[model samples]
Target: METLGEGDGPIDIHDYRHGLKLLKETRETSLWTNKKGYACPACGKPFEQLFTSEKQHNTFSPSSVTPFCIRREADRVLMFRH
Candidate 1:
């Protein structure tokens, strides 16, 4: 959402939500690449959990798939993938 690039820092909730919405609408397998990292807009927490490779991304079923660098949490705002 923030024009995917390095040195862009973390994305905000509006961007993250927009990305997820696009992903769902397009039924995309993954959100860009894990080449860079992202942060949770609401909490400002970096998304440390990432898929090491594209194969790993493909292995996940659609229902269980989430953003490449995002981590699922108990907070409702952080659960954008759902």
Candidate 2:
């Protein structure tokens, strides 16, 4: 058997409707960080995702998490992962 991710998706640190699990309810600000880092498909270098919020204090790991990419546009949203 293959080893699945710890969360729903490899990159699913937060839910658009239900919100985030790794972040605190009282803590304000959207930020994503991975110490191990993820390889960028375009640059081939490690990168992290940081959501802009009122403040800047948040972090998470991608070690066993799923790998996904979300892109939102004026018309629609796009998601892709291996």
Candidate 3:
């Protein structure tokens, strides 16, 4: 994964937010952020965030869910949904 602002070409904030929204909406559980830029606990790779879906394969029923932010662990992404 590449940083949103550091790439060959510039990307619009809309696109970035759109991707995040898609991940959040499609994801089964929730999205996780590896802000610390450390290896994932499960995969062991440097990531800014991780998406954990409660449903397998990021499948979900209704697609109206919204994403929320996690506190204290700004470096890591946490499950915002139940």
Candidate 4:
């Protein structure tokens, strides 16, 4: 794995690898969202929320859900109805 950031970025190689390992080994049921994004446990790769849908909220299993964070660009912040 490669280091994701140089100075003070959210991701690093270690965290990214750890996150990938955790994703494969663990079955997380709840989805966690944050504004600053999350660093992968093994390798430091930033994971962000790319998309969300309220209609599919209860339809999918928790194990299949991938927790992500939101990164605000400029002054625009995107929000979804839950």
Best by the TM-score measure:
3
lDDT of 2 by residue, 1-82 (tens): 1111223333333323232222323344344443344443333444444333333232335752456554333333322232
Q: After superposition, how far is residue 76 of candidate 1 from its true place, in Å?
A: 17
lDDT by candidate, in order shown: 0.34, 0.35, 0.37, 0.33
Q: Could you tell me every candidate's TM-score relative to the true structure?
A: 0.23, 0.27, 0.30, 0.24
Q: Worst ten-residue run, lDDT, model 1? A: 73-82
Candidate 2, which ten residues in sequence have the lowest lDDT sum? Answer: 1-10
Q: What is the C-alpha RMSD of each candidate to the true structure, in Å?
A: 10.8, 11.0, 12.1, 11.4
Ranking by TM-score: 3, 2, 4, 1
Candidate 3 C-alpha RMSD relative to the actual structure: 12.1
Q: Which stretches of candidate 4 lie over 4 Å from their true place?
A: 1-28, 49-82
True-structure RMSD for candidate 4 = 11.4
**Per-prediction count of colliding residue pairs?**
0, 4, 9, 18
Runs off by more than 4 Å, candidate 3: 1-28, 57-82
Model 1 ranges off by over 4 Å? 1-30, 48-82
**Residue 13 in model 3: shift from native, Å?**
27
* Superposed model 2: Cα runs more than 4 Å off: 1-10, 14-29, 52-70, 73-82
Per lDDT, what order, best first?
3, 2, 1, 4
lDDT of 3 by residue, 1-82 (tens): 4334343343233444533443343423455344434333333334454454333233334652543222222232333331
Mark the 10 consecutive residues where model 4 has the least summed lDDT: 21-30
